[model samples]
Target: MPTALVTGAAGFIGYHVCEQLISNGYDVVGLDAMTDYYEVSLKEARHARLESEKFTFIKGYVEERDLLMGLFETHKFDLVIHLAAQAGVRYSIDNPRSYLESNIGGTFELLEAARAYPPRHMLLASTSSAYGANTVMPYVENVRADHQMSFYAATKKATEAMAHSYAHLYDLPITMFRFFTVYGPWGRPDMALFKFTKAILEGGSIDVYNNGDMSRDFTYIGDLVSALIRLIDVLPERGSAPAGETDSLSPVAPFRVLNIGNSSPTLLMDFISAIELATERKATCNMMPMQAGDVPATWADATLLTQLVGEIPHTKVPEGVAKFVNWYRDYYKC
Candidate 1:
């Protein structure tokens, strides 16, 4: 069986990816810090579900160079998926140190380790927030995204550059996929869907950021996982990019960035309505201005993703929200 090293395997996306890899007959070594970023128990629970002979879970920080080097030397993994990073935009403002440590420092350690024992392909998770202040709708991967609205996004963008340099110097085939507002079953509590469901179900008002005028290309977890797995085979090759405007392939390296998202952007209030429909209850919205490090909207241009993977996140808001609500009700007993 092929061996894969999945960092942040306890996270929402990490857990699903690891589960899918195992189902596909891969022996996965999962590593996570299990920090209290959201809830450690939830992370533990996700890891618990993956316990098996094929999946080995290790609890540790990815920034620890010793741990990563030891694992890379031992496993010599066929594939490496980097998903462990300090998430959340608002949290980055209060605690920039954690972002530096996890997002920036962690990526550095991973790249160094990969340099020693290179994998066939290394897929790293980025965010749509990396688009930052770009007002252009349907963000294409080739777009120049320089102005980041948050420290969280800036660090993610830095990782893209970091990975590219490593890929260029060491011939590390890397795909940095940026995710737009990913949500689904077993989602993080800090996200809108989870928080909105919990509040609306408990008869509390949900905070409507940007006065509910914002929008997002909310990609479901299942769809995201499917598309991501597909990319593992679409290895980036130097000088193989077709001359297209949507191609984000680097001219100097076997590296590229792809936006993984539902191309359809849904309004924030519409998303809340989906939640209300799922819960069979109306949500009281507490209108709030846009928070620091937040954008009014995010939309993805997944042409490159489709061209490479032949699939995109197509789950509608209502359908995805209903799936999440069912999971929430079952998980939380609400």
Candidate 2:
């Protein structure tokens, strides 16, 4: 069976990606460190569930050069989906070294392995936060993203550059996707939807950043995974987007950065209200100023993504929020 390597397999989106690949008849391999950055139990749960006949998992850091190199040598992967990173904007402010090790160093190691044994296509995960400090509504992919507000965004952006260089030098077919605020069932604990659900369930106050005035292009996890699957098959050639119509794709390398987001940007209060309705409870809100290194809003111009993938993320906010709340309740036995 053709093999696909998915790093951060136990992660929220990684787990979903792995499941989709396996269902589509690809032999899937997952690598995760099981870091305590959020909750180890949650990560373990995801890994345990993915333990099946066709899925093989390795528990280790991607920065481990020998392990990665060995894996690449042993299994010439048809596709490598790199999703592991030091996530969380606030966390990067406290400990930037984690970003350096996981984001920069890990990416460097992965690229080196790919250099030796090139995959048919390599999909690297980036973030919308990479479009930092830009007043541009509905952020586009072709624009210069040099001014990242957070170190987390900086590292993700840096990896995009690094991957582009590798593609240019080795002629590796690569697709870099900049994800918007992805949220849904089995979501990350650090994310707003999850936190708000937990707090509301416990009858506690939830912190609303930017004085509840912020908005985000909240991409549902299922929609994001679908786009990724479609994109894996739509590899770009050097100096072109997939169909030679979009500019977001790179001109120098077989690499392009596509935004995977629901083009609708919902207000913060509305997002909180979705969770409240889903949980059947009202949140005691604590509206506050924008935290450092955080953007007030994020909206994705997914025109290029739609053009390349021939689809757009169309999940409704209320429905997605309800799915997450149901999962949360069942998972925690609340």
TM-score winner: 1
Clashes of 1: 0
- Candidate 1 has a TM-score of 0.99
Report how far residue 219 has shifted in candidate 2, in Å: 0.6
Per-model lDDT: 0.93, 0.91
- Candidate 1: deviation at residue 216, Å? 0.5
Query: Candidate 2 vs. truth: CA RMSD?
Result: 1.1
lDDT by residue (1-91, candidate 2, tens digit) is: 8899999999999999999999999999899999999999999898888889889999999998688899999999999999999999999
Tell how far residue 260 is off in model 2, in angstroms. 0.3
Clashing pairs in 1: none
Root-mean-square deviation per candidate: 0.9, 1.1
User: How many clashing pairs does model 2 include?
Assistant: 0
lDDT of 1 by residue, 86-182 (tens): 9999999999999999999999999999999999999998999999999988898998999999999999999999999999999999999999999
